[model samples]
Target: MIDSVQRDSSLLVHFTLKLADGSTAESTRNNGKPALFCLGDGSLSEGLENQLIGLKVGDKHAFALESEDAFGGISPDLIQYFSRRDFMQAGEPEVGAIMLFSGMDGNEMPGVIREISGDSITVDFNHPLAGQTIHFDVEVLEINPVLEAANADPVG
Candidate 1:
């Protein structure tokens, strides 16, 4: 029998991600290798993963996902500002440049430069895919569901 998600505890899939305009954004087929990932580990988005459940090996699917359901809708609060002095400390800000900086709590955050003016630079911290819908075309190349009945270690 083809192993379904509930019957198989985990899965390893080779995927091809595409944009709404039919452009290929990423794919495992190009590297001549497959990408392995555990299900329900947040490696795949919830909405997308939810759609994958119950599918067996060798199943091909194409679907459209909304921005909110995909990478998530853009957030207004993600837009931030940095003083000219701060910009100088980091480096010069160039339009369309992605820069990594420490947040107030010292956590690293990536910000994209959108504009620069006399005393401040505008940065957008939202994910590049934040506001755009994505089209996903996935194939279930393999399935490795966990075997609860197996005699091996539980951690594996």
Candidate 2:
């Protein structure tokens, strides 16, 4: 018998994400292979993860999440303007081009070019999907429950 998904269960699933307008944002179904990940691993938001706790193999589910529960609302602090000179070695900036910038913590963050003035370029660091509701369609392909240690005692 197949086990149901639990908080720490590892799962393989096929999923598709759509916008409120019914436009597909992303999907694994197109590739014909299920994606695998462990629960609570941060691959999905906590709100979305909580919804997967009781699914079994072969089960299909669909739901929608508001902006706050998904990528979240846009943050004004993430929008900033940089001097054009900083991108000199990279060539001229074009609007809508995504560029990676190193953070103070040494991790890279992607920023999309929004506008280019004479000496300033506006970059928006907010996620492209921010402020939009998301629709999710999911099919659970496999589930592996957390195994108990061999030395552990079972309680009746």
Candidate 3:
């Protein structure tokens, strides 16, 4: 049977992300490879995965998502200040640089430098694309049905 994108389909696709201004933010095509993932997996956002449903192999599509539906709106609370000494071990911090900070959960999170003062640096923890609309150009390359375990029994 021919495969199509559905709730449990696995898909291989190439996609490009662009800003509202037409600037390309990222593209799997640029890397010469397509992304492979299953629907409902964390690899693709729910909003984006929903858009792919019903698409068939070799289908191409373009769409836009608002800030709230994309990466979400920037939060003032995510903007934080840190002492310069904290980064002295790394080097002089520069505005526009991205730094990895340890979170309370013991995971590293990326924060971008937004400002530098005498002894403090302001970092924005929000995603770089936060608060901006994004355009997506996607091409479906392959689609496969989700595999069920051999031991699984079919139920009505």
Candidate 4:
């Protein structure tokens, strides 16, 4: 038995992600090779994977995801106000610039520049897709069954 993107591990695939505004956010079709990733990896959102399950090679699909199931609904806490001086100290912060900053736990997090006031710069650390629904267009170009995967695995 084999699973497509729904499987724990997918060898290769081609897909496109479109925002609610009908704009492409990401796509593997642009490249000649299909995108490949190990399942359960943080690379894909669970909600996005749910739509890909049970699909087979050459399957093309489109699905809409709610904010909660996608990057998760917008969290007020994720919004932070930083001092303009602090932002300048780090470097000249510009509107629409994405920044990398340390989280409270010291993990690096990415935040986008939203607004710049006199002394405060608002940064949104939430996933860009957070708080919004997204559409995914997928085409399964190939399926490497488990038997073939086992044969390729060194341990198997």
Which numbered prediction scores highest in TM-score against the true structure? Answer: 3
- The TM-score values for the models, in the order shown, are 0.79, 0.84, 0.86, 0.80
Across 1-156, the per-residue lDDT of candidate 1 in tens digits comes to: 447764324666677777778898788889867666566676667777777888878888888889887888889899998788987667777989999988899999998998999888999999887788788777776787444576587575
Kindly list the per-residue Cα lDDT of model 2 for residues 1-156, writing each as its tens digit: 547988777888899999988999989999897777688777777778877889888999999888888888999999999999999898998999999999999999999999999999999999998989999898998897333454566798
| Residue lDDT tens for model 4, 20-109 | 889988888787657765557777778777777677777888888888877798888999998977766588899999999997899999
In model 1, which regions exceed 4 Å deviation?
Answer: 7-9, 145-156
Clashes of each: 4, 0, 0, 0
Over the full model, what C-alpha lDDT does candidate 4 score relative to the true structure? 0.78
Model 2, runs deviating above 4 Å: 145-156
lDDT value, residue 21 of candidate 4:
86
What is the Cα root-mean-square deviation between model 3 and the actual structure? 4.1
Worst 10 residues of 3 by lDDT: 145-154
lDDT (C-alpha) at residue 16 in model 4: 82
Query: Rank order by TM-score, top first?
Result: 3, 2, 4, 1
Scored by CA lDDT, what does every candidate get? 0.78, 0.87, 0.88, 0.78
| Candidate 4 residue runs with Cα over 4 Å from true position | 1-11, 41-43, 144-156
